[model samples]
Target: MFDLDRWLEIFQTINKNKLRTLLAGFTVTLGILIFTVLFGMGNGLKNTFYTFFQDDAQNTIFIYPGFATKPFKGFKENRRIEFKNEDLALLEEKFGDRIEFTTARISKGTTVKYKSEYGNYTVRAVHPEHQYLEKTIIDRGRFINENDIEKDTRVATIGRLVEKDLFGNENAVGKYFTLNKIVYRVVGVFSDEGGDREERNIYTPVSTTQLIYKNTDKIDQINLSYDMAIGANGARRLSRDIKKVLKDKHNIAPSDRNGIYVESVIEDLEQNLQLANVLQIIVFWIGLGTLFAGVIGISNIMVYIVKERTKELGIRKALGAKPSTVIGMILQETMVITMIFGYIGLLIGNFVLNSMGNKLEDWFITNPNVSQGTIIFATVILILSGLIAGYIPARRAARVKPIVALRDE
Candidate 1:
């Protein structure tokens, strides 16, 4: 089935018409290149969305105290709402089954000193379950435990950066650090995917912080992760129920939305995810449109090429060449050009993306890439476009009378 003569002739024609062939090839190449890069950047944007939320658990919810705007039950408007250790207990007692992990947060910034090295860092007061809530990974030793909370022990779990700052190359476990002139032994060294900022804090027992700082049971915020089995709707219902309970318990007005701010991570996550999906769809269409433009460009070029070779085609037909042979020649040439240029475009696009690395992270494009399936599909589309583009003009040329085509200027 392989015709060496016909293929050699096709090559000879391509060789003789370098400028025209280059122009056709350029159109195809440019189209696929643009499509590849655009789709890759779209994927990069989606990656940014996911990476942004990776620092915290997706099922987590944060409850921050806010001032009441309306008066109720002798309580005045503008009253500051404060969460206590009892609030955490109340949630556990009420929604024990619905909750997975709960923690009361007390954040304080203080200068930490170990030996000759020292740095100012935040001290996060938390329960053992805070590890899951913050996605903390213990690299050495252990996180804060129940006994540490119960005993109000003067101990802390230091962040990786904190250890680096205060201890240099020395391991921080079992070491002592001074915070506010009070000595606390480090029990663990931890890391976070949240980068350097998150890894610069020190974690201690909530009870210990309450006793040392203000000598009260006051907490800054409440954070918890719900059981994943409780779907998004269930999380919303639970959020509403929590707000109502906290409102009624604090004697705030029923309609007071500002008194208790319950933020559901899943809600924001779902919305952003929807946005990411929409962007991808838009990108896909944009890429498809670019590809269509290339197909059109090549189609036009094929028509022009046939017009230029009209007399030559007529002579071949007069010399006993079949109409199918004429069609085949044009189709074969188009295919060869399209395939070579399309593959070149794909390679160049991928190389550009790879070379970018994380340099475009500021633009929310991380590791932009097109999948193998997409590459194959695009290649197939280009080949088919070539066939169709060449077929139309080739068929018109074949249908012309030898005398009429010969008379063409």
Candidate 2:
């Protein structure tokens, strides 16, 4: 078991054709490297998608009106459809319990001013629930409340970036800001989210918006959240129910299909996650296939090595070397080459992943490392590949006859 001489002889043979051995090892290394990198990328892409959806409730739905794609009754194609406050009120009455939170929004991009300092940005009129729907958090003061909506208060919540630009470090709560010369009180300051356009917005009550913007009883869009207990299927059913109510109220056909749009956030997220899972599987298989091919190449190279060293093996056998000794030498050489290079590939892949993970995380992608199970599986594959590659050649070497091998050049 501790045959120093046998190990020395194995190294001497491998040293004889160092370049060939190295080339074979390199193929395996390159294959494993590609496998590791591609797996990391797949994980990154999945995390990116999840991050994009994180800011919004996974079960939320958005309703917006667009031109009719299909002509219905006497209505012509491409006719514009508008949503009104009455439509939202009717939906709330019909599906009150099915809804978690509901709000309507109307946005205008205009300049906001306080004294001499002016910052131009978007202003939104939203119901109290808009804060929860959009995942808006207050840095100071409070968001729009039911009291503001009920009384049509001229109170506004500003984003952190807007606060810094208009007020600097000065307290903005209870101060006043004017949008389009319509005075509104600043009741809150919100934090920013890097590239979020919403972070620069100022939010006010939907009722206040309609009154100030002369949009009485009109809304551009409706945002709502459904109970998480009402899963994707239930959400889809509720969306259809809402669509039917809108079509009936608007005097549009149920089959008109284009007069209004109702979207389920849960449905979109579920579909996207499914697609991501498929792509990840494809990535894993491609990586494993490449690694397997490299392992096969190593097996072929070992076979060739056994063939080339037949005479040397034959001389050893004639000098009382056992078949087990010959086998042990070949197996050791194969394992050493495989484990060393395979480990190197693993280390390099992990280093690359760590370096890119942070930049990817800022974009909302999560831990991009291969799963522990996957790593363990790959290690097992590596060990088995080495054993198989070595075993076949060792079996052939043990079969060689002293008389025949001695005659070989």
Candidate 3:
């Protein structure tokens, strides 16, 4: 039960010691505030990592050709490496089981005109599989099909911003657009998570670009998605094997680094995620440290409060108060102060985080927030700290003799 008289006396004691009570509450409030903010910021940092990687498929890999730095077989040093349609077919044939999809990329910059509107935009000549590799979402129509690639059709898929820039609010699908004075029909209108830059580019059949740009089979890059079932270590091995195969085919020395570059998205993502996890762990420990400091502060303050009330506690015990009752009274007072101040800290911390919004995006912190489970856990800790802080001093006071306490100054 509720002990109205006992609570009244507790309030009177607190009323007489305003400074002491405020000090104890301030310690708890400050601790929880710092803890909440630090933990939320850690979560924000993690969000940044995910957001950055989400623009591309996590299991994807990119291959780029570079000038060979070492001579091998009949090939001389400083030979420029180039990937072609044949390379894409070779990977599909050699590593078909490990590869999910592959595409050859040929990038060019051209002025696009739609009626009276025109803009300078990038053009990506790619196979049908490039849609998946680039995570292109077809909004108004279908992406490039096998039929388009087979006939080297002059059909194009335009990005969201491309439609907006050159076609205004008009739907781009089934419309005609000119790239470098060559007309191509827009078969699809698409969007990308890669922001405005990606959404400003146009995609066309790799065969059409190869024929129109240079009348050759040259490609600038190769992109592929590896089977996710391969796991991280397997992905690394696959990348190494790919480099070896391509190097051998191109007659480049095995030790030459400039001949080929293979980038595994999963490998970089794993490393970055590990780093984020470590950072969260560090923030957790720091939050716990702050709570620990608050506990110690409250403990010291409880000891002082008990010392000041030594004579009063002795009188209550002389009047036949039980040890548990004395302990409960001190505990009730401690809990009231801790509960009020700790909750205030939680509210203020959450308010600060909410107000931050995207202001911290420049620092790579996005939507920092603490889960309800964390809040509940912290609340429990706060209550227990109060109990522990009160219990030790209350027990010591209850044990002191009435005569001994009354004689003290």
Candidate 4:
């Protein structure tokens, strides 16, 4: 098992053709490196998508009006559909127990001013239940309450960014801000959201926004939260029921080609996650194909090396070396070269991923690291490739007749 002389001979042969050996080894190494990097990037993208989806309630549904694509009830195509306050009230009456929270929204992009400081931002009119649907945590004070909605108070909640820009470190509550020259008292400051879009909004009661903006009966959107106790399938069924009700009330057919649009966040997220998994599998196969090509190259090179070294092998056999001993020497050499270079490639790939992963994550890309399972799997593949590449050439050499091998120049 411990044949120092055999190993020395193998090393000396490789040393004589250092450049050629290195080139072959490098090809295999680079293939593995590319594979590792690509696989890591795929995983990272999957993680990023999953993280963003996690921030919102999985069972939430959004409803908005869009242009009708087909005529309905004598109305021409391209008619604008609009939802109203009464529609939201009707849905709540019918599905109150099944729904966790419901909110009607009317929003506009307008400039908000506090004293001398001003910023352009979106303002939304919402009910107290909007907080339950969004489940957003407040950093200071509290969100809108039922009293504010009932009395149509002119109080507002400002996002963290707005507070910082207008009031600096000072307490924002009790400060007055103006939108469209109408003043409203700031009642609360919302928490920062890592620069999420919602962090720039200014929120007030639906009734107050209607009165001030002079669009009292119109609403831009409606958001609903279904009880998690309902389960995902049940939530989906409830969404369909709600959609059916809206279509019927609006005098639109159930199969109307153009009508109100209902979007289920859960369904969208599930579809996206499935797509991400498929993409990861595709990336893995591409990387493996590249690595397989490299293994084939190594196998061909080893075959050539053995053919060229037939005379040396014949001399060894003539000196009483067993067939197993000759095979072991060649296998050992191949494995050593593969393990050393393969590991170097793995380290280099990991280093590159680590350096870029954080920057990508900041931009909302997820994990971005190759999993331990994948790395272990790759290592096994490398070893097996090396053994197979070496075994074929070694076996051919072992079968050669010493007389014939020695006859060659």
Candidate maximizing TM-score: 1
| Best-performing candidate as measured by lDDT | 1
lDDT of each: 0.91, 0.84, 0.90, 0.83
What's the ranking of the predictions by TM-score, best on top? Answer: 1, 3, 4, 2
Tell me which residue pairs clash in candidate 4: 44-368, 48-366
- Using TM-score as the yardstick, the better of models 1 and 4 is 1
- Candidate 1 per-residue lDDT, tens place, 1-409, comes to 1689989998899999999999999988998999999989888888887888899998999998899999889889999999998999999999999999999999989999988888899999999999999999999999999999999999999999999888999998998889988999999999999889999989999999999876999999999999999899999999998998888888889898899999988887788889988998898899889888887888899999999999999999999899998999889988998999889999998998888878999988988988999899999998998898789998988897888888989
- Kindly list the per-residue Cα lDDT of model 4 for residues 1-409, writing each as its tens digit: 4678766876787789998789768878987999999899888888877676765677788888877667667777776889889989998999999988899988888888888999899998998888766666688888888898888899999888888888888899988889878899999988643355777888899988887766567899999988889887887898788888887777675676458888787887878878888988999999998888887888788888888889988998999989998898888888877877888888988998888856877755565789899999999999998898789999999999898889877
lDDT ranking, high to low: 1, 3, 2, 4
Off by over 4 Å in 3: 1-19, 70-78, 320-328
Backbone clash count for every predicted candidate, in the order shown: 0, 0, 0, 2
In candidate 1, position 97 carries an lDDT of: 93
- TM-score of each predicted structure versus truth: 0.92, 0.88, 0.90, 0.88
Tens digits of per-residue lDDT for model 2, 1-409: 4778767865786688888789778867877787888888788878777767777877788998877767677877777888888888888999999998999999888899998999889998999898888888888999999999889999999998888889888899999989989899999988743345768889989898888766487899988999888877899999998888887776677777778888887788778888888988999899989998888899899998888889989998999989998898888888878887887888888888787765767655566777777777777788788888789999989989998989989
Off by over 4 Å in 1: 1-6, 71-74, 252-255, 319-325
* Total clashing pairs in model 1: 0
